[model samples]
Target: MVQVDVFWSYALGASFASAASRQLKIKSNPFQNDYFTYTLLYLSCIFAPSGIYLLWQFPHWETMQVATCHGDLPAWLVTIFSITNITQGILGFWVSYQCIKAGRYYLAHLQWFLAYFCMFFVLVHGWDGLGWQRFLYDPTVLNNQLWEPGQHMGLTFLWSNVAFTLYVMGIFVIPFMIIPMSKWIIEGAQNSPEVRSTDIPESIQEIGITFLKLVLGCSLGGAIITSIVIYIIRLITGNLLISFIFGMSICLVSGYYFFFQEGKICYDLFKKLFLAEPATSQKEKS
Candidate 1:
C-alpha cells in the first residue's frame, strides 16, 4: 500500500505537471500537443468523480452560517463572500492575462495571489461549515439552535485547515511550479554551460534532487499514515469529523518528519547503493 501510494503520487504529479506545461506551450508549438491533450481528457475523467463528490457535499447557506466563522454568519455576508470569491477569480485571470500582454510578470503574480486568497477563504469557510455536522449526529443535541463554538473545536478546525492547505501545496502546487522551473533551468544550462556551472552549481542541483526525493517520500508515507490514523479514529470515536481532525494532525506530523528528516535519510541510502563513488563523494558535503 505504501509503495502504491508513492507510485500513484509520482505518476499524478508528473502527469499533471507535464499536461499543464504542454498546454501552456501549445500556442507556441501546436504540433504533437495531441498527446498531452488526450492525457488531460483522461485526467479530467479520473478527477470528475472527486469533483462531483465535493459539489455533492458542499454546504448550503443554512449549514454555512453555523459551521463557519463565529458560527453565526449572516446569510447576506455568506452571499457576499461567495460572490466576491467567484468574481475575483474571474477578474484575476483577466488581469493576469493583461499583465502578461504588457510583460508585467510581477503584477500578474500579485493579481493571481489575490485570486488565490479569495478562493482559499471560501474553501476554509466551507470546511468550517462542516463543523455543524459534528452536532447533527447527536440525538440529544437540539437541531433547532446553532451549537456554541468552543475554543477546542475552533482551534482544531483552524489547525486541520492549515495542514490541509500545506498538504495541497506540497503535493500539488509545488510540482506544477517545479515542472516549469526545471524546464527553464535545463534550457538555460543547455544554452550556456557557463550558466549551468555558475548560476546552478552541482551542489544546487543535488539539493533540488534531494528535495524532490523528500517530497515523494512524504507524499507516500503521509497518505498511508493519515489513512491508518483516520481509520483508527473512526473505529474508536465513531465520529467522522473527529476522525478527520485526528487524521489531519497525523498527516501533518508524518509529512513534516518524512519530508525533512526520514525521507532524506532514505534517499541518501538509495543513492549510496546505486551511485558511483564520485557521485557519492560530491554528495558527501551535503
Candidate 2:
C-alpha cells in the first residue's frame, strides 16, 4: 500500500507538470502534447481514484488486519478501489470531450460509450468484487463433489463471468480503436495549413520532440515492466489466467493507450515526410 501510494504521487506530480507545460505552450511538439495528454489520461484512470479515496477515507490498522486474514480488503480499501475505478470512467469522459472539441464526433461518441461502459462495470461489480451474486447463488455441482465449499454458484458466477468477459474484450478492442483514432488526429493536424503556416520556434520543436521521445520510451518501458511482473506472478503461482486478466485489464486501459497512441502520432509524422500532399487535401480525396 505504501508503494502504491508513492507510485501514485509520482505519477500525479508528473501529470500535473506535463499539463501545466502544455497549457503554457512550453512544449510545441505535437508529440509532447500527445504524450502529456495520454499520460494524464492513464494516470487519471488508474491513480486518481486511489488518491482521492485515500484523501477521503484513511483506512484503519484493524481494517488491514481483516484484509490480510481473508485475502480480501476492508470496506475502506474497497471504497478507495472504487474511487480508482470511477475515476477511470471520468477520464474516459474527458477523452471523449477532448475528441469532440477537436471535431472528431465519431471518436467522441466511441469514447463516451466506452466511458459509460466502464462506469457500469464498476458499479455492478461493487468495486470490491462482492457484486458477483450469481456465482454465489448457484454453485457448479460436479460428480456430487464440491471442489471448493462456500464458493460462488449459478447466476452469481454468471455475472462475474460477464464482467470478466467484458474486461477481456476490452484488452484487444480498446487498442484498435484508440491507436487509429490518435494516428488520424495527429497526422491530420500536420497537413493543416494553419499548423504548417505557423512559425514555430526551432527550440520549441526540439523540446517537443525530446518530450515525445521520452513519453514513448517511458510507455514502452512501463509495458515491459508490467509484463515482467506478470511473468513473475505466473511463475510463482502457476496460475496465469488471473494474473493475465488483471494485468491486461490494467495495461490495455492505461499504458497501451500511450504506446499505440504515440505510435499513431509518430506514424503520422513519417507519413507527412514521405507524402508531399497536405493531409487536409488527402482527406478531401478520400
Number of the top candidate by lDDT?
Answer: 2
Q: Among these predicted structures, which one has the highest TM-score?
A: 1
Lowest-lDDT window of 10 residues in candidate 2? 58-67
Full-model lDDT for every candidate: 0.37, 0.39
Tens digit of per-residue lDDT, candidate 2, span 91-124: 4434544543444433443343233333323222
Off by over 4 Å in 2: 1-71, 88-167, 171-180, 183-191, 194-286
Alpha-carbon lDDT of model 1 = 0.37
Q: Show the colliding residue pairs in model 1.
A: 67-128, 67-129
Worst 10 residues of 1 by lDDT: 1-10
Q: Write the per-residue lDDT of candidate 1 for residues 89-183, one digit (tens) a residue.
A: 33333444344344333333334222332222232322433332332222112233334444223335334432343355356445544444355
Return the TM-score for each candidate structure: 0.32, 0.25
